[model samples]
Target: QSNIIKAEFAEIGERYNDKRRSEIIPISGDLSIEDIIADEEMVVTITHNGYIKRLPTSTWKTQRRGGRGMKGAHTKDDDFIEHLFIASTHDKMLFFTDRGKCYWMKVHEIPPGLRTSQGRAIVNLIGCEAGEKVKAFVSVKEFNETDYIVMATRKGVIKRTALSMYSRPRKGGIYAIEIREDDELIQAKVSHGDQDIILATYRGKSIRFNENDVRSTGRKTMGVRGIRLGTKDDYVIGMLIVKREGSVMVVTNKGYGKRSDLSAYRTQKRGGKGVITIKTTDKVGNLVGIMEAIDDDDLMLITDRGIMIRQAVEKIRTIGRNTQGVRLAKLDDKTYITSATRVLKDEEENEEEEAAETEEE
Candidate 1:
């Protein structure tokens, strides 16, 4: 009788169900990967063979400019570190290819590795086509209206576009500039609106012009001429933005380099024959790279045979614009310098007497 009575009571309770005692509150959203990751300053390097990796800034010990840098990466005999920079993990890196396309990614997304490790291939990170190769890249924390993206081609063409225009990114990459049949994009730099620009050629000529001379254009337009190449074989090797204070350092394929004041290179019109930057004798070889550097900066030299040396900028002699520079790297006859870049000093680090000759993999 009791069981029957309990069953009847349960059925009556089910029929008279009340509202849920606990409240079901909706949450704002889920946590994203960027939100959980901490932003850090990293030493990022990309090799000519499309390998890239990021290591902590502490991986490099500050050495007096002119010492062989520690082995930055375990590169193959045919490959070398073409690009090394310090960037925050949260910054966005915009990569421009030789085929005139632009790809985008965050710096933190790069794989982290040890100092001597060969990095992951860049093809696995970005959407690059079969024949396309990355020529230049710039890191930006925020795109501002007052800034511009300046680009230069191997055939001496230059283009400027508003930085805000590239705020949006596409999957396969969009055209940053229209490349011609025989020309390829060589350099891309971020510039303030009012600074001067320098274009250096392989035959030891450089032209300096104000940024205002080049009119801003759409993403797909071909740029105007920045310099007049003397011969079909002569092409632009590098482009640098000039400031009021820093000196422009020019390096040759035979390991010669020198620093000349910004005042020595008089400002010229956009499309004129440039002044001689260095005397190109058989001793110095052709011009290989140019960079804007200061006394406190570090200079990185990379050769075609995958050797790299890092030295202080102050050690290089400041010479006249028309003279041949002194030997910057002791290179063999079969090897020649291929690229040069400047690294700003990190204030928090302590300087060591010398860097290790090699790093363990």
Candidate 2:
């Protein structure tokens, strides 16, 4: 039996003695990943109920953002797209939770499906701790110190940290910030550290301050206050970094909104009581959202009732600081504006002109 085993081994060894070689043979695992996985462009849609899905990018090529996006998701009536972003299948998506921890996943890990299909729950794709929910996320292709991440809390705390710090995260998730028990991270933005930071509160108050006011800090520290809340329930509802000059539009729960010039909001010391950015009353409800807008920028406002309305900023009627300008959306009872964002900084006029040209043709 031993002699038979040794003879078998010798036969195997002789077969590979550089005598068996083929010029056309290929190396193992050398196949192109693009071929194995289609590298086509994808459209990623995230709904308010923590659902995320991806469709082919061509699905939205001709459809402008405010022009009634092709039913991105058929979620519960209560759900809507709170955060929407674009990334290639090879990009990395970083999910920052309310608990101040972040989870990272490749864009392709998100399953691709029909535009109307309800997406997989975020919690099922990424591991989130109990009671933790995704508040904001950034799709990053490269992490560099040249870029900075500006984070704002619901309690008005603001922090800026280097983008390079998040280049490598642990599999179990790492702390993005040290948040208080009562405060949750509400906004996260990528900036170059020189843009102006705007914080709008729920009670129609807003403050614009230099981004340098808050010193860049490490990941484990609590941020400095950006806006001082007069009441316990008064928290920040909107935050954004602007590089260009524009008005800050404030939208209320009753769909009342107005655009006030940036010149109207004088830069003040951080943590001070903000000036009255708009009027709020028992009739008009508290402010629900805010955005930096130009005269020609097209803004999209979505309500909790699943209604999306788009209008040019010029049509919003720029007004003084202390007035509720006009009704942006006529809403039913109990329905309020959930989120507002600029669909395009400038392009509505161009799109309209092109449409008119086509009509003439």
Candidate 3:
């Protein structure tokens, strides 16, 4: 054995003297020479107690294998235990020790337990990538209050839900319930008291006008007195005249008992009492009275301020004939005019003219 060792050592030295040209060789032995010589890259091995020992030219490898008598078992400085246990990502690793206490470690923390199948699994799972899918089947030796299984992604954050912990498969994706945009409801209000009364030419037969239906342009007051309906007063009373061609007619009360007749005109009477015709144009007497000398359409309300509020011609009071009233008419220029007089029944003539015009058109 001594001669064999000497011869082997000589051969090893000759083969490895030139570091660049040296070849690695494995050998088994338990022999001591003053200084064992071999190729720098050579590896020597010895077998004993079912364990294999390897010797290399590097001191780092020797230390890693637990230098000298520390063979087979890792030394206190050996990091294999820690490297085998620590997670590689931003997650925690959990291990159940034989003592029943749970152990936890962060990705870079040193591991404390002997490497086992369960320990390996825990380490791998903790270092998984973000959004990585995982399925786990684990058994606990004993219940530990502090031992909580945190289901986290490789990112180390667990999704918060109403139930158990989970992680989304992908980041920045739409949620189960998407957020909605803001919406609102709008409404508009119109005050009848503020709207101005414009002469509107409507085609219809005998529409009735009521005080309630007629909106007041003038400020609301207890009663109609010295009031005007339309433009400023510039005409005489009892004379049904259209101030302007298209403008509404203005009827002024000249004196007492001088009533304007709008019988030829159409009119609508809304709310109020009495069938008084051409009554005195007293400032306080009657602002709106039923016509007695003309048809209902031929009546209008003569304001104390001399502006005539023309009743629409399409509206006719249901009251009898010979009633004094006014009827509203739309001229070719779309002007509203009120004609006051005794009741006139000329529907047939008007219809004939309408038909002729239609035929011509």
Winner by TM-score: 1
Error of 2 at 202 (Å): 1.5
lDDT of 3: 0.26
Listed per candidate, the RMSD to the true structure in angstroms reads: 7.4, 7.1, 44.2
Candidate 2, residue 232: the lDDT equals 80
Candidate 2 residue pairs in clash (backbone atoms < 3 Å): none
Model 3 lDDT tens row, 226-254: 11222232111221112122212222122
Residue 238 shift from truth in candidate 2, angstroms: 1.5
The TM-score that candidate 1 achieves is 0.77
For each candidate, what TM-score against the reference? 0.77, 0.77, 0.13
Off by over 4 Å in 3: 1-288, 293-297, 311-314, 317-361
- Candidate with top lDDT is 1
lDDT of 2 by residue, 81-195 (tens): 5555678887778898888887888788898878778888988789888888888888887787788888999999999898889888788788889999988998788888777
Ranking by lDDT: 1, 2, 3
Which ten residues in a row are the worst by lDDT in model 1? 349-358
- By TM-score, the better pick of 1 and 3 is 1
Reference-based lDDT, each prediction: 0.87, 0.81, 0.26
lDDT of 1 by residue, 1-361 (tens): 9999999999999998898899998858997777778888999998767799999999999876645557787888766676788899888889999989999888898889999999998777887999898888888988899999999999999999998889899999889999999899998989999999999999999999999999999899998999999987899999988764789899998999999998999999999989999999998999988988888788878888778777888889999999999999899878988877776443332133333332321
Q: After TM-score superposition, what is the CA distance of residue 42 in candidate 2 from its true location, in Å?
A: 3.1
Q: Which ranking of candidates, highest TM-score first?
A: 1, 2, 3
